[model samples]
Target: MNSDTRTAPLACAPRTPALMVQGTCSNAGKSILAAAFCRIFLQDGLRVAPFKAQNMALNSCVTPDGLEMGRAQAVQAAACRLDPDVRMNPVLLKPCSDVGSQVIVMGRPVGVMRVRQYVDYKPQARDAAFATYDSLAAEHDVMVIEGAGSPAEINLKAHDIVNMAMARHAGARVLLVGDIDRGGVFAALVGTMELLEGWERDHVAGYLLNKFRGDASLLDPALDFMQQRTGRPVLGVVPYLRDLGLPEEDSVTFKEGLPGLRDGVAAEGGSEEPGTGPGSLPDILLDIVLVDLPHISNFTDVDALRGEPDVRLRVARTPADLPAPDGRMPDAVILPGSKNTTGDLRTLRASGMADALARLASDPDGPVVAGICAGLQMLGLCVADPLGLEGGGSEQGLGLLPVRTELAAEKTLRRTTGVHPRSGLPVAGYEIRHGITVAAEGGEGGGTGPGRGGAAFPFLLREDGGPLGWGTHGGRVWGTSLHGVFDADGFRRHFLDGLRTRRGLAPLGRVVASYSLDPALDRLADAVRAAVDMDAIYDMLHLRPGRV
Candidate 1:
């Protein structure tokens, strides 16, 4: 079949030329490469949007209108200078387990399905994918499509809605990306091409070698040989970039969370194991520990903190994994978002971290304890899952925050922008959770019933008219259902400054360096543009190359 049959153009589509980035393997840098194209197009003064037919990942974001989509597309949208929309990621699969996931169609969860069951829904999913694609294509001048995993997964190619199938459906030319950092780049590129069917092979316009290290001259011979063998040119060789960070696509990002099992620190620094003594942690302006839940989601919430040179962050799966307070405890303890709150909470308690956190929170001079999403619910007095939404009926919480939560049938998804009650600094973040938490009847100590005594001070204001988070003056505990709360420089600086003060450390200057995605995106695009032939890419897309 030709491109017309594969990805039939929508009646209203703006006749925009599309290009697809497929990888030789998962984490082969397809997402960032697509983002590079998006930024490039935007810089050329072309309106652009990023597209992914389907994304299977726990990391997600809620659009301004309360629609959910994959975080990768959201990042790409930012690179394109556009607002993220559900249309960017038509079908999102948030895997709750190895065997099943909650299927989100057009930004709302319809239901959960097993791996086998989702196969039966592929035809319908493909249609939905095109519908969403057409919507964006109708508005933008260019669409940069990102493929998931590899296109050569022989077992999954028949029912595939991503990769080659997506390329065909979008009538787009494909650039196959392979990571040289993983080694065997030559074998991987050749093997992938050999595995493709005749039409699939023809759809690919060229090959892009990503994450390359060493001299470019050393790779010329192999590139020539590959081009001769597969008749596909090597478009570029992107050098191994340092400090180029982005939100990871899966839990693999937390490969560092279990440092006891792995050697060497990961690039993300989520894997450091606490040494035997207080000196195990390197001296830094501030230290923070994140409870590494079994099914942690949106841990990128801490990505911004990594930008603060004076801050040191670590992830702990158990109490013993935590660094010895060594008379100087961590400035803050963060409990991040979790896919399964009740289950992860049980894991937390089993690991003895929950009790440890309670003690820390109860200590008047202890580190500031903060929880987001599932972390927020875990701090409450009680949590209920009547329908067993997260694998429990009812469970006791850390009781650090005077609140109670119940997992409701519908999820609360919104992009919230508000001001911190105390800091009066503007803060913005998104909330994606199934629980509705309310003030419990308990007083300062935390009671079981609800009353005026149970009221807690709300710390975050919602643009839609609601309290978003709670904090206590005495306990130094903060809880919020909002994820990405740290992305805002004003709020993060204000919050971290409080911790710095509590720890007797000097506060930061008037302006703290804020974390942003723009510069990183520009760097990414520059790398790809310098390495890849824009003339060839423009030719592949049937467009004239603009001056670089």
Candidate 2:
């Protein structure tokens, strides 16, 4: 290694206590662990915030002040009972292709670049990240820092701004987390430490073994060996949590299995069956198929819907995954958000999924077709990218709605509250997109009417008296730009009730409570507190028991 690239200790410690959580690999539970620490610190009466100098995720959220950041940081902010601030995650890299990504600095897009180009731009990115970190550290009593990928990536270490480099910059104690569920926990931990430089090794205060499923005592030998080998204490062995009820950070969760479907099936006594059978209750279990787009984003929008007792959610990646001609048709079809509207739309068209969706919407007795954000844009007459914002092109849409969309340079990001005029229920969500959609001129069902029964109507009337979405075919084919529209308990129940009424079944009524993360956060904190040595963690930070 070059002398200039050699790791060095911080010149002075940060006044505010900071703890950094780095992982042995991607999906080693770094984000969740950071969130748990945020909650744990908050419960102990100390002000805490989450920070990640850089994040690479397509799944994102809009802050109350209209800035965009990684969804994981937003969840962590919720754990701290604070609104998400862009400073918490300064640089966000959204991959648009295998070798290129759209770099977002301080929650705003700069430009797209290839891997080598981004590496060249690391100096400026590092400056922005350090500035943001300094500002946040000045305000919060403690900051829980999360790292991207592994610190042992030697090839990228020289330009690294997210892993051990960031830990050293913040003068934070490092907690290296390894996934026991992925096996090779011992080697992964030991190898990571062996790969780190001397100063980086000094920063590592302890080790955390995540997703441990077996007896804790069974790990005594291995834990002892790891501590002796690395000279760091084994702080925790977190249990494998099931149905954690928290939104995932990205699409990696899909690779393991469809998340909501597994829980829904287990809820029904492990039945793989889809719908209600003979002599079943009149409350029909509605099958809702979500089109898994090539660049799907904000998939957590449908998480609330999946938790409903009368809903069965499934992901459809291709035409074959959709309902068969001879098979039972789904009760509803959802086109979720996408990062690349034009690109993903082209893929869907090429894969014949577009044609299948057209057929479903055309069938009078077919399922309700709904779309969100980019999915809403795709359901329109066409999507045009005049400036080549989405790789510079235009594509024909499914023509399910009488609207046309044009990609714009400026993205709309804001928290929105509105009301569903049909059901008179309050609705709230957020908007994060770069598309401007308007009604088609001289087209049938193109007029903006009241949000009520009609061939075409507004989906919602915003609190500011503006229309947010459109619907056609008397609301059978509809879409909205809002991301979390279905999270409202009353509106979600009403929407599901509409599906039930169409199938000649009774509404299940509002038996479930509104969704909240407090219980889940508390449960997670309790688990970590029980399994981990919290006193040692506090002592590492030089913090006493009462408060900061």
Candidate 3:
């Protein structure tokens, strides 16, 4: 132990206790573990919060107050039974290309810069990160901090504001987590410790082995050896959770395929064909197809339906992936949000999905088509990027909706609550974009409301009576700027039931019940609490078993 790390009763700073969960590598369960502790602390009657100094991912969500943050922290906030705030994740890097990103500070875009240019902005970003952490600490009794990547990235250590720097700033007790399922857990854990600086090593209070499979008792010998080598106890071994149904922090998890209870299920179509025997409705489950655009953002909007047992969600990256092998059409097609709308629209066209989708929309019996955010923009007749916000040019849309969108210099960001104009059910969501679409005159080049067949009206409204997203009267096609409208149980069920009615299947009396990860949050926390030593963790943070 180092003298610098020694605890002096009088010198100790009195503030909210914080514990950091860092991983030996990226995707080593750091976010999930932080969430587990957040829920556990909240369950113990303590005010808790989740924090990440910086996050780099396309997956993001809007807070109730209109600030944007990482989706993982939003999930953790839900686990803590709290609304997500911008303070939870102060620095967000939304990658716009391989070498550049649109830097966001405190939930607003600062500017676009290359990776090298971003290094110079670190000092400012770091200051903003600390400011958010300090503000969050003032309101919560405990803060469960999550670190990005690993603290042992020696090449990037100097600009490391998210990990070791944050640990030192918060005086946080660190629990280093390693993934045993990835193999060589011992080497990864010890190697991480050896690479860290002496002060960084001193701050680590214990180690955790995550994503373990098989018998826990079989690891007793390895655990003993690790403790003997590091003088730190193995805090816990989290079992490999199957179908955990939590929104992932990034796209890596989906690289193999969507992580859900149905991983082994077929990638396309449901168990039964589109329809059942004669005089019987199709035995097919709800088949929802999602377009996997190159720069897809906020794809978590469809997570609720993906996890439902009766729903089969297929991610279509190309035209061939859209239709089933058995020649059955999907029940619904959803176009997700995208960071680069024009670029992805081009990709959609080149991949032949644009033509296929147009055919689907043209067929009277075609599946219901819906879009959110950028998807809504693409559904319109024309999208103009006058300022070259997303690469300069005007692009023709699918022409499914009679609207025109123009990308602007200013972005509209806000959290909203409204009622479904047709269903009359309440809906809540958020808007984060830099364009405005309006109804144009009929037969005008710019386009107007829904064309000849569909009636045009705003989809929802704010409590202040302001208009929100828009939808079509035909009900077969809808588009909205709201990113999380499906989060509302009533609206989601009503929409799904409508699809069922279109397919001649019986309506599901009860929806998935909970879609915001509430059930999975409790399940994960229970497993973690059982595996980890609560008493030791409390002692490490010098915290009592109650609210402050």
Candidate 4:
């Protein structure tokens, strides 16, 4: 269609043929491998790329093009040094309710389509999937594709874009990854391979064993026996990187315990580090509770906190599930972003959390309650349902802050800049949401306007304007559409530092922004290499720098 598409032949693909790094199950380290491999290829000075045919998760993100896609694709894009775009992830299915989803095609929210309705939409989804692969393949020398949860899930095999079907369609080689940490790594690997039908089985170029604990020498014999029996290569046996920062796909990987890794207690609690800044913040444990609402998206917001030795965080699913801080009350409670705004609101209310939250917001001495995205919406005075416009019902909010949220008939998403007119934080992260919580009601003049950044004006009303869900008082309660808001330097520490100061604790000097993610990537690659066949991995996949 254009000059770039015309010479698409030069578009880079693995010279020896690209190999996929799919996992036996979810969180089997497939995403890490994708990012790590991209980083490794980038380190080798070659222009590498990443792709994922279909990623189904509430954890979504905005691409540089101002379109919505899954956050994992964003991470992989960062690893490969590419600007995030919806093309790399053309078909994004973000669920709005239990049985419904909002289908995003080519970076735009097309319509609120039903799941059952998508069954016959294959012809459309396949065309977009191939178009995306072709575009990415044309730009780089090597493309690394990440598959969805366990290619072995028998019932989910059809309408499949992440596994064998994708491999065959793209004419790409595949590598299966199984988590040894889950204990039946051998069975999982062999079982998955056994389920593949004919040609689908042939695309698998190799296999990788991931997340082994201590001592690889002990597993050598098992490795030998399996290699011979399965006729697949084991690339590398990787040890787990305890502090890796690759964001997780869902809450299934969540862990709860005393703050940080330590002695005598939690085997996974966390550990003592040098005063992670001023008056020893990372070393001074603070108890935290994360409100586990249904429809939660972008859990990565809390990843850094999870890695912190001083801050103890846990997910609490109900009003009675409140986790106390050490021997005292929780120091803070975070309401992470979610997809179904009105639904999450109703959940809070039905669970009797509505009364608990109202009391907490009114109590000056209660644990500080904070909400992000939909969590932020719940904290408002009122939150209305969007379905009502299409002729449905609505619900009231927790009313912690003066804000109110009204779900418009249309959803909104984009990448934009917001200077903290408020406090000690980093630069703008990114925003992805479907509803707007305002300070008041029915005051918005129009539903659309121009936004400063790549963002569209979805704010129900302007700052001076009043809409059904508008707000007045800010600081104590805050709402933003941005994700990764807490990741910017000084953002988390500065905020945590304030918490310490409130409790009369000294400020944690300088927060550690030098987390050194590159080393983590390299370490993961080395680990993945163990479960893979090294000789074949390099010989078959690695092309010198620019030689596609």
Best by lDDT: 2
TM-score of 4: 0.84
| lDDT by residue (tens digit), candidate 2, 1-548 | 22233224456776789999999999999999999999999999899999999999988988877888999999899999998999999999888777888899988889889999999999999999999999999998889999989999999899999998898889998899999998998889989988998888878888999999979999999888776666787999999876677888888886445564562233432222135653452235677888887788899898787667667677788788776333677889999998889998889889988888887777778899999999899888788999987778778777788778999888888889999888889989899888998777644532122112234568887988777888877788889999999999999989988898888877767645467777888888888888889999998888865577
Cα lDDT computed for each candidate against the true fold: 0.79, 0.83, 0.81, 0.65
> Which one wins on TM-score?
2
Each candidate: RMSD: 5.2, 4.3, 4.0, 7.8
Q: Give a tens-digit lDDT track for model 4, residues 1-548.
A: 11121111222344335658888888788887888788767776777778888777777787776788877787788887788877777887877676777777777776766777876675688788887888878777777888888777888678776687777666676778888887999888888877876566666666777777888888889878666766665667777656565677655665332233342122353544454654453336666677777777787777667655456676677766674533455667788887776777777778877676565544556566677777777766566664663225666666555555677765566555544434423345566665665544432221111001121123222233322122222233444555665665566776677667656678666875444355666766565544545556656664554454
Ranking of predictions according to lDDT: 2, 3, 1, 4
Taking the tens digit of each residue's C-alpha lDDT, what string does model 1 give over 356-448? 887776666778888898888888887899987766589888877888899998988887888777777877888899999887664453522
TM-score of each: 0.89, 0.92, 0.90, 0.84
- Candidate 2, superposed: residue stretches over 4 Å from native: 1-11, 263-283, 324-326, 445-455
In candidate 2 the C-alpha lDDT for residue 231 amounts to: 72
Candidate 1 vs candidate 4, TM-score winner? 1
Error of 2 at 137 (Å): 1.0
lDDT of 3 by residue, 182-229 (tens): 898889988887798777886788899999989999999998877777
lDDT computed for candidate 4: 0.65
Error of 4 at 109 (Å): 2.2
lDDT of 1 at 30: 87
Clashing pairs in 3: 275-282, 276-282, 440-448
